[model samples]
Target: MLKEKGLFGNIGVQVVIAMCVGTLVGAMMGQSASMFAPLGSIFIHLIKMLVIPLVAVAIISGAAGLGSSQSAGKVGLSTLGFFGLTSAVAVALALFMGVVFQPGVGVDMTGVEGMFSNVYADKGEMPTFWATVLGMIPTNVFQSLNEANILQILVFCLFFGIAVSKLEKERRDPLINGVNAIVDAMVWMINVVMKVAPLGVFGLMADAVGTFGFSALMVVFKLFVVYVVAILIYGFIFYPAMIKAFSKTSPLKFLSAMKKPQAVALSTASSMATLPVTMEVCEEELGVKNSTASFVLPLGATINMSGNAIYYGLVAIFFAQMFNVELGMGAYIAIIVTSTLGAVGQAGVPGPSFLVVAVLLAAGIPIEGLPLLFALDRIFDMIRTALNITGDAACAVIVDNMINDGPQETPEPESSHHA
Candidate 1:
């Protein structure tokens, strides 16, 4: 009976109800609700535990499966290009928000220790750009895997897959085929993990509701509205204009097709978990080729972070504002640059990224301001996850267009979305 309603139907329903109930009960009791908080934290950890392996194998396997390593570079570059474009826009929007809203005025909060306490600027004897590039070459594959350094793994897979694809049919085919088989197995394991995502999400929701209740909800509501407005305007209007200029597909049609996956992304609040559905929507619904979808979607899911980028900037500015931290022009630039880079560097889980953000705050910045938002992170996470998926879809369309000779004939007219 429960299965018939769907995993989303059951788990999503439970989570919302849990949040509402927890919030109501906590409010009545005149205390922060602790019940269900542990469950939620555990669920978040479980989802996080799956992220490292899932990201590494998914990228490697996705890259190698693209037929030749040469094409893999093409896909990787396209993916990076998409990420670069969206991230830049995100930072710009954040800066604009900071300036227009003047979030950094007359705020005060006490800084915390043992957390992110410094800016990501002027590290002593920093490596050169070329050196940083070279450093991506993993010395030990297993070491990279253990550390879950996605960029390094992606680098290895692109070149290695290209080499395998360039070999004689007998040798290359067997090797490439073997890697695909392994990737498939890993994907299956990821699916098994996702089966419990609702439980995780539910626990996360319950804890957040119990702890923060009404006041946190109000803050989250404000943040959500602001961020969603930014993402929607940029994703739907600005991005579509860019797409129309560069690609043949209608942007509205493109976005309409992605709605189902986006909905799932919003509900789950995990880009990686929503990937399988997003990939399907791109291929079956939007007519993106399998190679394009596989190559673009996984990479996007891992690194392409429009929502995270914007959140970093806005949150940083917001925190600085709350703490009455005066960020001069140089400091503002540093915030934008560091936040953008950190989005790439701290690419695994939401929690770890905060640690990176904490570093930004520790540098005589506004670390104390961050805790003000912690109570509302989960709510913002849902919207950000949706925006992340939207960026993925947009990239898929752009890259698919770039690779194909031109546009294919349009598909039959029908309602574009599917659940």
Candidate 2:
């Protein structure tokens, strides 16, 4: 294992500096800043190349370790329950903020109107319950791997991991060791890939700022401000409070340790790409067990999207207010349910989200102004992603506390080594 020894060597510091520098360059260069896209692209590609394999092996090792424990069933159920509870709470918070702030009230859409169309009216209708369930079932797992279908891969890995846990001790030990060895290899690969993370962050920020421009912010700046407020509430205050109340973890300590992974999430704007960094930090700094962190973190990245839930809830309010559509009791319920479901349905990848469209339709809001938001989606996505990974880590810490018997996070003061 290798560690960044000092402040300048610290990846987090380097990335933060790169982000600031990139933003200035992008603002100056405008769209021409896109030349930096390749630096970001290669960085993202390196991270993505490891995601599928890392996820599969991590889940296998994690689930297998848990399956050997008596609390396996409890941990799984508790994890799901925690995610659902937090997501519902996130939507409620967003709705409250949207109403109080009134960000979309009396906004002019003079020029952006032409950008809207019913073309996307047929937009991605979320899958049916059975469809989503069946989709998780990989008919051909190898094909799923080739296609990089994360949900399907997760399902197969959990099942295979459990089965491995049932194996005779001699046989199981070697397989688990092999799977864990693969995870270590991934850590090494991530360490190597992260050498360029500062450059990647710079390129990504420059390209996004240059291409999207900040002009769009004027129209939705209110919504954007409210959005950030809601995200910070969830990410910083709510998550840390959860850790303090439910686990032995010090809120301040956990928050401080999480900076590196959150930085990665902010820059990449994709939880999947940030998964490796999140896992390392959880295991190394947060003291979450490999067994617990591996299973919970990967699963959290895949399905627990409290951050996206906030985005959906707020977006619904933005449109409903701008169009003067009054939301009824049922409409509020629909927003809450639809937003939570839609958020979970989404893969933890980066792009302009269409899930908000479904949320709007569910609450009978206008969809015309969606494209306007799309222009600034990357900025919104980056902030929310940082929040999303925080929730994932929070869940891992709390759930690990609930079922594990004793302290798992031994303080390691002598070693500055990292994953």
Which of the numbered candidates is closest to the native, going by highest TM-score? 2
Model 1: per-residue lDDT, tens digit, 8-54?
46544555555555555556644344665576576556666666665
Of the candidates shown, which would achieve the greatest lDDT relative to the real structure?
2
lDDT of each prediction vs. the true structure? Answer: 0.63, 0.86
Query: Model 1: runs farther than 4 Å from truth?
Result: 1-33, 45-50, 67-73, 103-135, 216-224, 355-364, 406-419
How high is each candidate's TM-score? Answer: 0.78, 0.94
State how far residue 191 of model 1 sits from its true place (Å).
3.9
Clash counts for the predictions, in order: 11, 0
Model 1, residue 157: what's the lDDT? Answer: 65
The residue-level lDDT of candidate 1 at 290 comes to 64
Candidate 1 to truth, TM:
0.78
Segments of candidate 2 deviating more than 4 angstroms = 405-419
